[model samples]
Target: MSKRNFNKMDDDQIRGSSRVLRSSLAKKGGHLDEKFKKRKMTDLDPRSSQVRNQRGRLNQTKVKGTKSLAEKHVSTDAKKGKQGTKTTVWSIKDKHEYKIQLPLSVDTSISWITGCHLMDSGEIIMTDFYNKSLKKLDRTSATVTVCDLPSIPFGMCYIGNNTVAVSLGQKLQFANISGDMNLMQSVDTDHYCKGLTYHDSKILTVNDNSVFIHNYNGKQERCLFTYDSNAYFQGIAVSDDGQRIYIASWNIGLVTIDNKGNHLFTLSDPELNDPFRLSLDNHGNVLICYPHSNIVMQVSPDGKNEMGRIIKATDSIEWPNSLYFDRNTSSIIVGCGGSAYLYVFDLK
Candidate 1:
């Protein structure tokens, strides 16, 4: 046999061969929809989630699948009490229970949004990760102003009465999130800090594959746990008592974690092709936007009460990147990175 030189092939050939290997490994018995039927040995089926292919056509059937999961998991707290009292928790088994739409004017490629928190004056504070800016929108005045930060802001959590904790690219910083976007203190880290949530006097942040928990005063306490490193992670939202954390992993499932970042539960819906951002309403319902299908899914924390499939969530929502819920008003806001729009869905 002659001596072989492996460097002779071009980049495409090498990549093509690697893709073939990955495809083979990915085919471990999960039956995808007809849309993902195999095409070639070297090419990942267009319907497969390779993330390298273009956005394919939305599948209404798949969207419905995700909706059913949400309906099945819808919170039942409301059923245990009075009915129709604005104070009563609404258990939605379908999207028809609430209104979904793209909000007017406010648009941008928002990597994330601070959950709608009313300031001391009743204004909503929102920060955009990709836009690298923060804004306080006056609910009564309808005026908006920007908040400046030391670095690119990724996440924000409204700390009780006045202040908000903001997560910087490499550290955790305190901002006058309730008033004037003031940088108070910061926690240094070695990983790329992406999301933050506050609970029970503790602040949690997601760093790459690991989750870091710190004291509210910006001091490193310890790492809660590390997850599968391959999961592409993003923003986070926490429940009221601070026991549950809702994690949004791009193209992955919606994961639940403890205050210390310990993985508690995961709702990996095969029909949920991608979940870019995540948020939980006061009713404990999860509102997610699936761009590929142009549908906004309102699911129960347990993945119940799914609405029929809709492609509208992907229509004008180019690159739906971030999602947040205004617990005060029960509204859902979605951040579209490409179209530069923040679509707000009123759930009153």
Candidate 2:
């Protein structure tokens, strides 16, 4: 029957009937604490905040369900704690940066950009394991050259004047950009490597287990330092002035080592999650990328005499693989493979 037809009686009859219904409902189980009563006994009430709260609590107690992430905790304004660095300043949001579309139609799954270095001729030398080639990008002419290599190239760094040392398939390959297609030297090792940088006349490489430092000429390989098993090292960077060497671990945070690879400090903890790549800004601040979370993190220098802010590109990146900070223009470049674009952010 319709509600209007059932309540066709006078107001007095309706009041009396509601009073009797309340009395019957109270006697059955209403006397007990509302919180302790079974939900089945509760009546559906659209305006009841109490019911909503109770239902939320009930769902939280259940273990097997898709849980929603806490929005406020990850919000941009939630917290900006000073970790011996300047407050993080986001200069670019996701999908808001400029993208440089590549003309090469290679359909390889690019894992990471690995390393970026500007040659003496102002060419951007980017290494990638996707095509197993040393790719050269002429920023001025907008031309890209892919050089075939015997194996995968993981990392590249300028060793001396024009020599670049590349970590390729458990070996170090040295080549001079000005010379012919000849390998100056090849240092063989059993360690799985990723990032490469040079400091204090030594070549630093991040192994799966630890960070190793060798002579710039690739003559020797020795363990300068090691971290706990918690850290899966990926990227390595050395300051131009020769004071710091920053190593990016998979998720264990960054370990700042000195010239000898002796641990100077750790920039992150277990709570920071994953850091896939590392780059140094012109001001010596450490720029990091969290691939799983799709965010870029920056850690300022110890002195914190930094003027430029820590900028992040959020919108334009879908799985940001690498980070490169151009000191001349003060622009940061992020390579996102899904979008197949490079995101650039400016910080002042």
Candidate 3:
């Protein structure tokens, strides 16, 4: 053999030699790359790109399957009254037994009872929109005008133990209702105020198509969100956690949004023909009153399902406008637009 000339070896020759050495070691079940030296070399090697792709697909399928199972669990648990599921507390089967008639006098001149709230003491407060008056009915059914508003009083909600905030056109009046209704202060808004609710120490008001959020002192913090003008926004309610807001419209059903003013979804069920006012039970179930349909429906928080009609038209519910769920009594107080009677239903 001639004198070895290692220095004369070209790049291709060196590479070829290394490949041969690696091939020999590989045949002996040895790995050449330090990164994968100790790894297994099965047909389904974890380090292989094909295996990784397969794993990714499997993980995706597993995630989807888990979500589907969770959804099914919610549906099944609703009927079973289990946690993580909507309990069917309100139902039509118990409708007739729970109906309590309001004690309004037959001679009362109240035109349209638009908004209402229930106090812990079992008192029902309401706004006579057409009469431009705030009225209260004690637990004994004795009704009286609490105070007269300058503009039409559309919506009202309790802001304090003995105080309430009433929406009157473009102004929100803070009224004290301890002994008698007295205007404490007022807050002005850019748009008209139709419905009002308090959440996270803030006042949420709605008008034609816009929702406005304001501080307790009447300062407009922001316009929460606006809906299409074709649909008239009527009733408003805020979730207990202040994370979600539910709005009722005339033509459209209900619109739900996050606290950050993001539109989450719309609930326009055929059963929710004319959603007027909305309320939330302790469990965050949506209680909606439909005037045209003369019915009150309980819906899931996600707006994907309607629990059922809590009070149906056949139950003698007519022109249901304002709705409130009383935690103390576990009852729903419904005020009508034209009728002098307020219907109370105790959930079983």
Model 1 TM-score, 2 decimals: 0.60
Q: In lDDT terms, how accurate is model 1? A: 0.49
CA deviation > 4 Å runs, candidate 2: 1-112, 178-184, 269-272, 303-313
lDDT per residue (tens digit) for residues 258-346 in model 2:
77667777765443445667777655577777654566776766422222324323343444557776666556766643333345666
lDDT of 1 by residue, 224-296 (tens): 7677755555666665545667776644566777765667777666765555456666655556655434456
Q: Please, what is the whole-model Cα lDDT of each candidate in the order they appear?
A: 0.49, 0.53, 0.61
lDDT of 1 at 302: 49
Pick the winner on lDDT between candidates 1 and 2.
2
lDDT: worst 10-residue window of model 2: 54-63
Order the candidates by TM-score, highest first.
3, 2, 1
Clashing pairs in 3: none
- TM-scores, all candidates, are 0.60, 0.64, 0.69
lDDT of 2 at 208: 61
